[model samples]
Target: MLEKLRKLANILYWAATAVLIALPIAALGYLLAETPNPNRASALFPHIDIIASPTGLAFWSAFSAGALSFLLFIGFLWSLRGLFDFYRKGQILTLHAAGAILRLGKWLIALALVRFMTLPTQTLLLTSNNPDGHRQLAISISDHEVGFLLAAGLLTLIGWAMNEAVRISDENKAFV
Candidate 1:
């Protein structure tokens, strides 16, 4: 069982690492090719693709914000990689795993903030490009984002408890 877990972790670690590398390349591709205007962005994210409009003061702001958010997203994946690395070595309850999990919580919170900023902007962007129809402005948070935040909080609590347990075990072993 332990061996199987280790193997699975190893495979997951590699898979995540590949994604960490590939995602940016793909994002860059989107920026260079499929990206819409930068004035405002409508993401409906978590559920749909982003809609970017090039016709507002929000363009550069939205673009820059998206870039920063992407960085945070990458950081989240990197932290996951750390967790997987520890698990692959059968060190799931170690300090490294705890730290990685804590980092995941931070990233999740940051991601939620990014979503808040971009979601409203996306509504405008989605309608801005329509040649005849009046541009529409809309914004709403998705259930998915809320769920992600909740999961993040749970992971943080679990990791903190795991770290404390490991510390107690180490102290007990010291007396033995």
Candidate 2:
């Protein structure tokens, strides 16, 4: 039963990771496909304008968000690999592996906090009417995107933690 539970957790974790990676890519692709114009809505955050030309900062920001998300997906894969090793080798209780999983959880939490902090700034930047307002709004929007990415990361981390705890608890029971 413990083995079956672990397998289920692994499946869920991988599936969630795939969805996380795919979402940003899809959003970015859609953004790129849209003809750039000052009046155009943002691909990811619908309220923001596309502006006449994409700034290096905007491009880099998007790239970074996508890249970070991709990296998290890779981390998820690593966690899955560890889980598989535990399942096959009955090594679930290993402290080293559990610690690695916890580290991943911490990363996710950090990502989420980053996102939460910037969301308000992004909202202000995206909605401002004047030139100064627009600039400020742009900054705010970028912050908001970061915040969203972080939130997603946090969710992923939470999921990983839950799985790890479950596995650890089950392993402990076997000893008792």
Model 1 over residues 66-135: C-alpha lDDT tens digits?
Answer: 6777898899899888888999999876777887788888788888778777756654654555555555
TM-score, predicted candidate 1 vs. hidden true structure: 0.77
Please provide, for model 2 over 64-102, each residue's C-alpha lDDT reduced to its tens digit, 9 standing for 90 to 100. 554565566556556655555554455555655565566
> Which portions of model 2 miss their true places by more than 4 Å?
6-41, 49-54, 117-130, 137-176
Question: Which parts of model 1 have CA positions greater than 4 angstroms off?
Answer: 34-57, 121-137
What's each prediction's clash count? Answer: 5, 10
Compute each candidate's TM-score over C-alphas: 0.77, 0.48
108: Cα error in model 1, Å: 1.4
Candidate 2 residue-wise lDDT at 164: 76
Q: lDDT score of model 2?
A: 0.56
Best by lDDT: 1
Q: Deviation in angstroms for 54 in model 2?
A: 5.4
lDDT of each: 0.73, 0.56
